[model samples]
Target: MKLMVHYTLKNKGLLFFNFICVFGFIIIELGLPTLLSQMIDVGVVNNDDAYIKKIGLTMLAVVIVGVLMNISLRYFMTRITTNVAASIRQDLFEKIQDYSHNEYEQLGVSSLITRVTNDAYQVMLFMQNFLRTGFMTPMMFIASLVMVLRTSGSLASYVLMVLPFLLIGVVAIAGFSNPLSRKQQGNLDRINNILRENLSGLRVIRAFVNEDFEEERFDKVNKAYEKSSKNLFRLMSSAQPGFFFLFNIVMAYIIWQGSIQIDQGTLEVGNLIAFIEYIFHALFSFMMFSTIFMMYPRAAVSANRIKEAMDTEPIIKSKENGVTQTETSGYLAFDEVTFAYPGHAESPVIRDADFSAKPGQTVAFIGSTGSGKSTLIQLIPRLYDVSEGEILVDGVDVRDYDIDALRAKIGYIPQSAVLFSGTIKENLRYGKDDATDEELEEALDIAQASDFVAELPDGLDTYISEGGANFSGGQKQRLAIARAVVRRPSIYIFDDSFSALDFATDAKVRERINEETTDATVLIVAQRVSTIMDADEIIVLNEGNIVGKGTHEELLETSSVYYDIASSQLTKEELGK
Candidate 1:
């Protein structure tokens, strides 16, 4: 949090200049009342019109300079605040992109989103207020207090009596507001979580006709946010009245003393007038400080939220002297590897799992849900580190190789067929940044996506809606496959990427991929037995353990799981047809 402040202030030099101008403007404002008092005492009371006009012009000049200074300060302050907010948001976004899965899980997506959007905005507002008022108020208050004391020590006693109580009031407010502010941010994160879940699962909700249920759930979160916000603002609202009440009591003391001095012929009318002006300046300045302090707790909570994300360091890192395998022969091996998620201490996801695929050989993993099929595939690209053993590529531990070099060799198509909102060509080119039109078409033809693509008016340039909502499920899946094929990676891992496609299209796509890249290793995780029936080797997973390993014929006789899965699917020729 301190570092964020340092970085924000360091980049905003104009804000500092604006701070100085504001400080000078406040000092000049304090003199206006004193000058008015002088005009009344020296010119008007003494019947000197020239002197009145002279002091009046001086007052006008001061007012004009003060207004101009204020306008200049406001301009710079707004610019500084806006730029700082943008830079902070940009840095935060970049950090999130680089964050590892472990880091993301630790800070839930809902909280991360809230911190990036709402919390960042809160910090910006606080900084704007801090620059505009934080510095000037305290200095002006203290300076006015000094003037009041110098004018009359007796009158100074009245302010001293009330100030201690005001300080105590502010301290009490800070203590209460701090915890409430933190709670408010937590509530906001919960609201974000609720909304994110609903948005992502909107299709399922409509399919099930559960809109009312989802709305009820959203209402609960919204009500919580409202309650938390009310509590925070309730505390803040009391600050103004509390200070005003105490200052009013001090004003009564001034009136009482002024009546006595008038009877004693000691205090002049102008002196009392100046004293009243000083009291307004001093009290209001303190009040401004109090208001700023009231907002500090909320902004501080936001800062802490943002700092938590920025401070995280990814678990997976590249070795300093790691070598890049520019021309990987596509040999992948897992040597006695063990891994588990952070909270699951029962057993490893891949418990001493061992396997190897030589260049050009096809390896398949057949598993039920939660059988660690995806986790096992993630290890090849160093998405996660092995807990107890090493995962090797080309006989070297993947962790010992440069992260960029290792990932570049493997093309991964996740279970979900995610597509960005852009042209079909743009999404396909992500795998190979320099992919030409010919390369895109070649890959699309292999993935069985070229037929539909060619039918579109723009062909490869047809726009894809968010998450490929414009296309069918199978179409999105094939495009994702095409995206992977365009990379021309030495190793391809399709993690249940073909589940949506029909058996005929799936078989044709796989055949094309095998034919086009004979030297590339293919690793697949699939639920359908037919998908991996003809692979060189298949490992069957159950309860995170590889219960069976054999060819399709060997598995049918030896493994119950394999036999049952095979019985559910059609024969190879039927599936191919």
Candidate 2:
């Protein structure tokens, strides 16, 4: 609930005006009943037609004023609530941009999407109803009760007796609703997560022939969501009827007793009419308030989920006033770096890894599947910081540099090729925003992708589908390589990026890159030994430890781990060459 208030503060002026509208409307509404009593008791009793006309005209003016105030209140509420929802979503999005991979993993992507979209909508819905009824009802109830007590104390006593019961019902319903709301939201997260997985992995599911299994899995969560929703609604569905029933019974008693007082000449007919009006206002307010109370629990649950994401500070916080530039480029060193993921501190994925690369050098790492090859290169970009030691870039600790400035110096191509839904030009501009068309063509030539891209009718203007689904795996990889080459960065990192291409294309791309990167450092991570056989230096990793570091010929005779890997992938003729 406080989450809403925090954003609501941005439009305090509108809120004040909205409050004025509600107050003015309540005054007009309460005043009309009193004016009606005067018209009936004085004008009708004395047969004064002029007096009746005057009061009737006055009542009409007040009604018109009340309608105007209501219209104003509704306008202010609509603007403020919409603005607040937008602000909340925008801030939440900015917060998400700052998150490191650790936060992304901690808060699942599907759940985060739900929070931004569905949860934000829930807050907006609650605000819409709340602004309309929340302020009006309580003040209306108290003011009308005060008037009722003044008009006739005996009738006011009956209304007071039911106050405790109504209050008790509100508290009890809210208490029961909160837990159900929490359960329903949790189930919704599960359904979204399952849906995301099913869509993203549709090919794998079809390949394995598991459609029925997936359907059953989806149905399990759907039914659970249905059950929670049904229970919550059943409780809500029964409440209005019960309240209305109690309302009818109480109204009957007040009217019957008032008629008796009138017959005895103890109560004036006009006074009795005004008393009934006040009682109606008070009870009607309680009815409106009851609806708000019913919605509060769900809104409160949604607000808490949004607040949790807002409160989460990213684990990797760079130095506030960090260095923005360096004295040199294409120089990197990892000094006795040992790192585990955030939780598994005792079991490191990279152990005591000391390495350095200077300009004009090509360093390649080869290892088995879980040998931490890709993880090691990721350290250079500070994707995940080293747990135990520091990594230096251009003779400065990476942590001491502005994070964005540090990333700007390197062009990294991850193992998975990613392309957004846009023309090739837009995707290439992501690497270097102001890159010229000639520069783009040159980068594509270096990556060996210009041949295919030139075949397209639109060439650079050809639109890519989401995740480059329209492109072949090799084509996507080459485009990703071209994207990195467009940057002409100080250092280039290709983490198993060439695995998708054939040997000839891979070799051609590497040869062109070597010609292009004469002044920049290159780091390659690969599973294929042929990929790194011509490197300036090759490092072999076994488990988390670095077992070998040397040129191809040097490692073949000296390091068993390197020899075993090279011998399995290279033919005797190629090895000899």
Candidate 3:
């Protein structure tokens, strides 16, 4: 919330101007009822036509000013709110970009998405209401109370007696609503997570005819959310009407007491009328206060949710002593490296993993599904630091090297082929923003994605749906490969990026990448034995331990784990090929 305030102040003058306008409008609102009371009592009841006409005209003028001030205030407040929201969104997005893999994973995607969309929206509503009702309600309440006290102290005492009830009601509603609002946001996150998963895997769900099952799961989440929502509303519903009733009871007492004073000649009819109007104003202000109380709990919950994400410290941090390295020889080495995830104390994901890939050499990692092949490659990019031991890139501890500089030398393609919604050319250009059309085409050609791209009506201009849903799995993989290739990094990491391609296409793309990138170091993490069989060296991992390290022939002779993997896909005849 402080972060949002800092951004809001960047346009300090505009916001301050909005404040002046809002306060001015509040004064006008307070003046309107008071003026009407005067017009009715001092002018209408006095039989003074001249006095009535003068005050009546004055009231009309005040109304016009109030209307104009209201318009200006609304426009200015919107300007302030819009600018503030945009700035906060930008800063939040920029912070997200700095987050490491561990930090991102810990926060979880659904919660972050909710913060960006729903939570930010809540903050915006708070700001808008804060400027409008937040300021006006209190000023009006206090000012109206003062006016009533000056008019008649005895009746004002009745108004004062209602204060405790209003306060008590606000406190109770706030207490009950706070926990439910938090639960509501949490449930929203859960629903978002489920929806995200189902949408991403919609094809698989339909293929397996599991629509009913998924629908039932979603129905459970939806019902839980609905129940919580109803409970919160049921609790909040009491404050509004209950406060109205309490305030009106006080108003009736004031009216009855003032009527007696008027009949007894202690109070004039004009004063009695004015006193009643002031009571109503005072009560209305209390009602606004009650409304504010109702909104506070939900806004506070939303603020806390946003704060949680903003407070998360990135598990991976760059060292102060780190220096940028240019023109790296791309020498990679893992010396006695051991790493484990946050939980699972049984064994490290990659333990004492010792291996190296020299400049211009292709090193491949192959193993069973849970084998630490992908984990080992991730260490090279410093996605998660080694729990114990060192990883060296270009003969320097990877941590000692500047993160951006080290990453500049490495092109990483994850197991998932992620592409944003954009033109084919824009996605490719993400690797190297300054990449020319010729460079893009050359890289796409190397990845075997250019042919299909050219067939599309817009070619490189063709628009991709979110996550490249417009493309086939093979095409998405090829485009991802092209994105990595466009970077022209000295180290290329393919973390099973070729799995979506057919065997022949995968082989062709790998050959092209290898031939074109002679000076680059290639590290492949693949499930297929055939993918890495021709590598200069292969590391076989099983259950977080390096079970084997050798060439294909050497592995077949030395490692049973390697033999099992090789035997799974290869017939005796295919092995010969």
RMSD vs true structure, all candidates? 2.5, 1.7, 2.3
Ranking under lDDT, best-scoring first?
2, 1, 3
The C-alpha lDDT values of all candidates are 0.86, 0.92, 0.84
Per residue, candidate 1 scores C-alpha lDDT tens digits across 1-577 of 4844675676557867887798879778888888888888899889999999999999999999999999888888788878877877888998998777888889999999898899889988988887778878888888888888876778878887888888888888988999999988998888889898988899999999999999998898889889989998999998898888888888888978977986798777777888888888898888888888888888889988888888887788888879786455789888888898766757678887888898678899997788889999998897888888888888788988888888888899997999999999999999998999999999999999999999999998899987789999899999999999999988999999999999999899888988987888999899988788778899888777778988888888889987777766767564333
Which has the better lDDT: candidate 1, or candidate 3? 1
| Best-performing candidate as measured by TM-score | 2
The pairs that clash in candidate 3 are none
lDDT, residue 396, model 3: 87
Can you list the residue pairs that collide in candidate 1?
Answer: none
Report clash pairs, candidate 2.
Answer: none
List model 2 lDDT by residue over 475-539, tens digit each: 99999999999998999999999999999999999999999999999999999888898899998
C-alpha positional error of residue 289 in candidate 2 after TM-score superposition, expressed in Å: 2.0
- Residue 166, model 2: lDDT of 85
Alpha carbon lDDT at 256, candidate 3: 89
What's each prediction's TM-score? 0.94, 0.96, 0.94
List residue ranges in candidate 2 displaced over 4 A: none
